[model samples]
Target: MGFATKKSKRWELQQLTWTFISIVMFVPLPVHIFPFVMLTQAKKGKIRSWYIAGIAFLLLELGLFASFVYFFGTISQAMLLTLTGSVTSYIIGNGLLLNRAKPYLQRLELAEIRPLAWIPTASSRNKIQQLPQAALDTPQLFIERLIHWRKEIDNRAIHQNIDKIIHLFQLLEQNDKMEAEKFLVRHATVVNVLMKYDEIENSRLYNSVTAESKKKLEDVIAKAAIAIEQEVTNQFKSGILDVSAETDVYIQSLKNRNLLNE
Candidate 1:
């Protein structure tokens, strides 16, 4: 089997083991352990919805246990409770997953609609040539191409930075995350508007695009580009300053130990 298939099978086995423990034990201890495992998996972006339902089921079971020292009931009653609780938890988990899946599907659709110009390969030039002109002219494509033009930096670093920003946004469901998402949504809207304008100009509706509309679109693109450049410059400057300071401290320490000449 492929490595990815093997890894996925392993995860499936782990989840099954925990689930069996939770159901067979019919106790809060095994139930709680499964939820914690699911939560860790969710944080790693594996299973997204099970943790919340598992946690709810665990808490309910714990409350029942607190009321009764042991499951002082008939075997049939215990089995009934386990079956009901497990079914309820499964329904709740599936419901939450469906809710999240909607936005996730929409995002995937949007990404497909605005495909990147650069493929991670030596054949990127041919791929770009094959794309429609509208895709080539998008602000997002422009930014991606510009970053790719910098041969000195590894492209993976850019992806890593983007992942870090995404991780930060995922850390909370509060106002900060909302505000950050709002800013990104607004930026994406602006870029899409510009891309649509470009498409119209390139299409048979070129005569319909008024000069004023064209000017406004150009202005928006220019301002957005300037803002992006400034942000990148600031980040690079900050990194350089930090490195310089650290280097100076190291040099001073070496001089103090007579390990280096003035």
Candidate 2:
């Protein structure tokens, strides 16, 4: 089977396991077991797991309601408890747990670098061409691609510098400076250099010429990483100055209005 098919099957199996556990454990005592299961699944960083847990909870609740109505001939109190539990679980799971888990999940996804599937004889040109244009355009996608490239290179120094560059890009994106024209140009330039390095390192003919080109590209990559770091530092410094100026203006206004002591 293909990679996507394998991945889908794996997810299905996981969901099935969750469904079984949730129903088996929760059908008897939902109040005690449901929240625990939800919390556990939520921490796994899979939103689908949450949905599976919820559906199982509903099935359990339906079963309980039926049992109550059949035995006691009244579901008024049982229904009330069921409604309260469902609402509480929804609020706590969806509003609180999922919200808290999303950022952590996103970071994990961003940090994961998947390997490329290609023959060893594939040309560097073909390898570079395989990279999607969309990946290079978006900051998050570009960072992921950079991580994959970093893994391909065996140099420790290059790895450290690339890690710094990736961190800086993330910082800039958090500060909303990723789309600035200068930064965009710099990002594109760094990607180009890395692509060239990937090409040189993976070339079939590794003579002195390729070796020299590889060394030059490594130096260029190191320099580009440093430049990106410096750019991020300057951007942060500018933000600090802007915040300080605003704070000073606010303080002055407050003093003029006697809202604060001079």
Candidate 3:
């Protein structure tokens, strides 16, 4: 099995084990809340596992109940416990399943909508070991960290931001703002690198980028982030910019004006 599939199966086993325990204890009280939560989350698969465990418990309880009644001539308090436990197990098991699935579900939805395109690819093994220790501003530092950890980042949102940043550079180049285009391209390379790190693993290089340094770097990027913003405003004022055009179309238009170096 794939790593993800194995991990998921392990998680399911854990959940089943706990659900079984709750069943034996006659306190699947979470059933009252988790079922409704599962419904709202719309993740029914997880709830199905809970039902599997609950049903198994119910079957076992029925066999035991029959034995007790046959020997003792009465359906004892165990019957009451079984009835209540069964009800709560189903309800709460659903809720627990949905709750556990929430983050994965949200990320899956986002991945569907934001199709991956033209993300610069490089291996973390190629990362440079040492960086110059000279004084550098926040944007430069942030970009440097990106370059240093280029192989470590793997977040979709960061790549999306890089896409926008690339588009902005193309826009600047089209507007004869070659200097700004070059500046951002040089600085934002790290942003792209950091964004493309492995999603499921911790990046040692990424972890090394300190928070205080990141905050300062963010401030710098924000201030000089996209010089194309001003150029876009100018184009709009001059009636030269097509506001309705999709970003890709505009990028194509700019590329047609000048060849973008790979």
lDDT of 3 by residue, 54-149 (tens): 455455445544544554544668766656555655555645554445333322222332322211111211232233323323332333343334
All candidates' lDDT scores? 0.44, 0.57, 0.42
Tens digits of per-residue lDDT for model 2, 1-262: 1121112445444443543454444333434354455545544433444545656765655665565455464557766765566555544443433343323233234434322222222133235444745225445446655655665666778878887887777678778654444466556766667777777777767799988888888888888888888888898899999999999999999999999985
TM-score for candidate 2, residues paired by index: 0.50
| Between candidates 1 and 2, the TM-score winner | 2
RMSD of 3: 15.9
* Candidate 1 global lDDT: 0.44
Best-performing candidate as measured by TM-score: 2
Candidates sorted on lDDT, descending: 2, 1, 3
Question: What's the lDDT of the predicted structure labeled candidate 3?
Answer: 0.42
Residue 163 CA displacement from its true place in model 1, Å? 12
Q: Per-residue error at 238 for model 2, in Å?
A: 1.5
Each candidate's number of clashing pairs is 0, 0, 9
lDDT of 1 by residue, 99-214 (tens): 44322232222233343332232234324523434333333343333322222122343334333332333332122434444435444534354444455455544444565676
